[model samples]
Target: MALAWQGVRALARREWCSSWRQPAEWLTPLAFVIGVALMFPLGLGPEPARLRELAPGLLWIAALLASLLPLPRLFAADLADGSLEQWWLAPLPRPLAVALKLAVHWGWTGLPLVLLAPLLALAFGVDDAAPLALSLLLGTPVLTLLGGLGAALVLHARAGAGLLALLLLPLQVPVLVFGTAAAQGGNNAPVALLLLGAWLAVLLALAPWGIAATLSLMLD
Candidate 1:
């Protein structure tokens, strides 16, 4: 057990280091999130009540789109450089490696959005940053996890990014709806969060294997 965890940590650290070397990997999505938050006010007018009203949905949409920016690059570089083959054949469990990669991806992309969401909420005149932060906390993982599945599904495709967006956006509808409702402090916040949590749990159990299998087939 100790050895397995060590391997997972090692792989995660390696992935993190590789990504850290490339500022654009994390920064581009972050910039997009910040840009959307800033731009909507100009287009929507500067009324506090109106900005507050739109903050939940607008921020959620921006976060969702920004999440997409990193998916295509998630496994592409590894595959191109032949590092993915080493991961698949390593002594460490395949799913664990995949899960670690997903965790790292979320840490870089989804986590930044969650942390910055409150500031964006504040900018949009949202007094209760709690709901916005909480909604993202529950919602972004779903995007990242299911996104891994889509990323793997279209890994070597001609237009992987377009296919990834098409594959993920429809499945992400429930998450978006519930996340927006939670951000808006609707009556169903608890139920919505619980549902999102359930969705995340399902992805955690399933996505790693799906990613590993798809990659295995493609690489073999």
Candidate 2:
């Protein structure tokens, strides 16, 4: 078991290194977060109170959208290059490998948004950074994990990117609501965070298997 996890970590690191070699894959989501944050103030006027009121939702929305940027590429490149076929044949459980890949995907795409959230929150006039950062930290993984299932489902479809967005956006609605509510840190914040955590836990347990199955079906 320990050895399997070690392989998972090693595979994840290799995937991260490959993505790092292509700057655009991981960087675009971070850029989207900043760009979307910038636009909120421009479109809504620069009132501190108003921006703060809107910041939770705005940032959550941006993070959600940015999460999607890497979905299509998650399995597309591996499929194209036959790496996925190799994975299928490996002694390692394919679902475990998918879990590691999704973890790395969140590390590249979602972790930055969590780290960057505090600064962006201040810019948008959110006074407390903890709630925002914590909410994103817990919530973004759910996005990436859920997205992995969607990405796997559409891996071989025509215009898979568009299909991915269409499949995922509806599922993301609950995440958006709970995440934004948690970030706002009001009376219901704890409840919202608990819900997000529950959702994350469920996804963590089930999504990798679903993704693995979908990808195998696609490949077959």
Candidate 3:
């Protein structure tokens, strides 16, 4: 048991270091999210009320789109360097390893979006940004987990990034709907947040195994 935990820690450390070194991999997605948020005011005119009305959906959409930028490469580096095979062969359970990787992926990619959501919300003229931030907090993990699954499914496909987006967007609609509703803030916000939490819990229980299975198929 101790040995298994040690392996998990080692893999976690390695993923953290690897991701830390690649600033662009994480930063680009954040930049994209910010860019999209900024563009809305310009395109839609500087009407605060209109922007505020649209803020929840626009922010969620921007976050969703930005998330795609980092996912295609989630396993690509490990695969190219043979690290994935080594990890697969190790004693650590593949699902645990996948879960750790997805968590780390969320740390770098999804967390930033969640953190920056409030600032983007403010820019969209949202007076109380808490709902937006809260919604993103609950929802981004689902995006990352689902995205990890899509990334694994398309790892060897031609134009894998685009394929990952296409495969994932449909699967992400529920999250999008609930997340946007939560962000919009009102009587419906609590219910929307609850649904997002439920979705996150379900995906947390299932996505790692799904990703691991897809990866096993790829490696074989």
Candidate 4:
């Protein structure tokens, strides 16, 4: 148990360190999240009323786009230098190892949006600020998990993260719809949170297999 926990932490730390070493990976997504969010006012005519109505959709879409930017690097970084082969042979369990990596990746990307959401909401004059941010906290995990799946799914492609996003973007629609619906102050926050969490949990269970499979195939 201790060994696995240590491995998970090390895995997370490794990803975090690599990301921080290249601040662009971290900064660019955040800049994009904030930038795409700012566009809401112009596209929707800038009325506070209009901004309030549209903020949820705007934030959700921007968040997903922000999440995609770092994904291709997920495995390719390790694979490029033959670290992936070493990962598969690690003493720690693979699923837990992958989960830790995803958790850190999302922490850098999705989790920050949760913390930074109020700014996003405030910029757009969104109401029910607490619920809007809360919904994001709960629902954005689905986006991260799907992003993890995409990272794993496209582990070997040329421009894998870019292609991964293209593939996963369509799969993201359901989360986007429900997540926005929840954030927009409606009758569905509880239901949406529950469903989104279920989605994340499902991905947590299944995504590693795809990642592991992709690694295994690369070996053979």
Question: How does each model score on TM-score?
Answer: 0.96, 0.96, 0.97, 0.91
- Where does candidate 4 clash, by residue pair? 72-161
lDDT for position 212 in model 4: 69
The clash tally of candidate 2 reads 0
How would you encode candidate 1's per-residue C-alpha lDDT over 164-220 as one tens digit per residue?
A: 999999998888999998888868888888888888888889989888888888887
TM-score of candidate 3 against the unseen true structure: 0.97
Ranking by TM-score: 3, 1, 2, 4
Candidate 4 global Cα RMSD: 1.9
TM-score of 4: 0.91
Model 4: weakest 10-residue lDDT segment is 210-219
The Cα error of candidate 2 at residue 19, in Å, is 1.2
- Whole-structure CA lDDT of model 4: 0.77
Over the stretch 13-123, how does candidate 3's per-residue lDDT look in tens digits?
Answer: 999999999999999989998998889899999888899999999989988998898888889889999999988877799999999998998999888887887789878
Error of 2 at 189 (Å): 0.3
The lDDT, on a scale of 0 to 1, for candidate 3 is 0.91
lDDT (tens digit, per residue) of candidate 4 on 13-87:
787898778888778889998888777677778589878877888788887777788777867778788877767
Candidate 1 positional error at 38, Å = 0.4
